[model samples]
Target: MNGTDTRSELEDYLRRVRVALADLPADELAEVMEDVEPNVLEAFEETGSIEELTKRLGTPEAYAEELRTAGGYPPAPSAPTRTVGDRFSARYVVWVTGFSIVVGFFTGTVGGGRYASDRYVVLMLCAPILALALWLLFSGRVRRVDIESLREYQAARRTGRSAVAQLPPNVVEYLRSMQPAWWLVRVVLLGVAFIAALSVSSEAFLLIGLLIAGLVWAGFRVRQDRRVLPVVLVANAFAVGMAVALLSAVISDADSSRSPYVTADYRGSGLWFDGEPLDNIYAVDAQGRQISKFYLYDGTGRPLVSRGDSCEPSGSDLTNEYPKPEVDYTQGGCTTSTNMPVLPLPPTAPVSVSPSTSVSPSTSVPSSAPETAPGSTPPAPTTTG
Candidate 1:
């Protein structure tokens, strides 16, 4: 093969090794790329062909692995799993769950014959997040960066220090000074996400709790398993999706069927239907306070006309036999549109008897007055004119 062809092949092989180790920390990756390229070029020079070099050195990935092991590197951290099958399965679950959450949000917003604009809002909110997730999954970033070796990461760190040293001293100091602020920012972000997830729905308590547990587990295992980041990404996506959906709900002024206040769900009485009064009736507001007039809609959202009426009690005499006056409802007449008003009990009136008619207790009482033996005849009564 021509020198140009050999060099091109050697470059391609080195590129593959770089790609394989791309998930390593940035400094570590740079170190690996720097180390691998020289060795492959030297091998290519002796072998005179890419095929012969590969046969002697193995595939680029295998070659990288050998180099990593010989250099005392740790195996690349991965998502906490045993095999590729487990890794991909977990990723698939994450994707499905994310999409499900988005769909659920949309359906929950507009499921019950809601306004068309609400559907549009749902689409707008979810489409961008889904598109980004798809791009992350398929663009080879998540799929390609899983396997790495951490040997000689110390050297990588030294290189990072050197790079930082090259920056202006003041710039470096400024960055160092911001470290605490950066940590605070991270804490605040996590705190907001956690609070938002818990606050969004009582029904999601278990799910949110599980997600927090997973996050904690993944955090501890992240350095050992490269796939943990993918899991974290998925979890963060779910959390952010929930937060967004909840915020949208709050901001949209959507009427909630389950509002804590009864006033929100109060439907006017069936006094009117379809922009006309069903019958001549007085209207009251949601608080049960009477309104001279009110406009309302029926269950099907048809507008109804309201009638004006006096809520005050009428002047008609209420007989004690009935205990309440019966109201006569007619056009331009007194009407009782609400529950009956409770009337106060009447006061007792003092009774007066004429002195001439007064009788002593002994004379008036049958037991005490004119008590005689059963055998004795009763005295004849005399009448005074």
Candidate 2:
């Protein structure tokens, strides 16, 4: 082959070596390539042929393996043969992971009131499944190669590297330095989540304890075993989801409590008395005669407008008018009553007068008896049967 063809073959060999070493850190891979390119070029020039170079240096895959060993790197992971048991074990892990995600979502959405106790039971039941998954992971039943080969895993790995590469070196270093702090933070967050879970059901204390233990174990093992990364990510995702759920629940409760009586736009403003919405207002004169129509105002003289109920066909318009028609709906149709007096007024009692005191025609007697002069004892008032 001509020199150009030999150079092409040499380039192809270097490409394969780089592909083999792609899993290495970017800086380390670059260093390895720097050392590799010079040595390969010199060897190719001396050999004068790609065939001779292959015979001397072995195939690209073998050469890369030798370099890995010399550099004290882990050997390349081999694709595991998918025997029936291995396939079953892998499927089991996948199903358990999916189950965990579903349970997490469910707990986040309905983790209160009557459902709280049930959630703890569900969590307790899930402990065995989670423990089984951990066992499989630690026992090597689920191969690391299988995880690395997943399309989502590979895509995530590439995306993470790309993102890190885009960041400034100082920023990256700062992030790396904060990793230990992050581990502690995540543990604290998980602990809080566990406490929240415990509050719902004391029965699931064991399950929560198990989960916290697993999280700590995973954190410790992640450096030695990359397989633990997915677990850590899942646990963190769950903690975040639970936090969002709790925040939403609190906001929703607050809104529900206040929404019926008041709102941001004042559209929901209504007459509320003693923590309850007042549907209607009734008015009566001093003689107990019902006043059918009247307008209400506050001490400041602003109209006391309240949201009208279904009895008023007009949309949510505020009204100060009293004695709104009481509305009731039945299967037949709706009925309304403008009944003025809902309660009966007692009979008025006659006023008593003292025989000794004579009132002038222009003088007006007070409704209540006038105070007795000085210290004189007054006669007891009589009551009609």
Local distance difference test, each candidate: 0.47, 0.63
Which regions of candidate 1 deviate over 4 angstroms? 1-66, 72-203, 219-224, 249-385
Root-mean-square deviation of each candidate, in angstroms?
A: 22.4, 12.7
lDDT value for candidate 1? 0.47
Candidate 1 per-residue lDDT, tens place, 1-385, comes to 5433454477678767766555555546656666666788788779877889999999988887787787677765564334665355435534544465555444433322223334434433443554454444444444433322222333543576568757776686688789656444434444554454354443243344544565567666554343445445445555455456556666654555445344322223223223342334333333334344444433333333222234454333211111122344664766544433432232123224332331112112323222234444333324222
lDDT of 2 at 99: 73
The model with the greatest TM-score is 2
Q: Report the number of backbone clashes for model 2.
A: 0
Query: What would the TM-score be for candidate 1 when compared with the true structure?
Result: 0.27
Task: Summarize candidate 2's per-residue lDDT along 1-385 as a digit string, tens digits.
Answer: 5433465589779867766765566446667878898888899889878889888888888889899999999877675245777657766766677677567556544543344766656655665786687677666676544454455556755787667667776787787889888778667756766676666666644555665686788788665455565566556555556667767888999989887554633433355443355667776554556667888655345566665545556544566676666666753576665555366463244334444342111112222222334434433334433
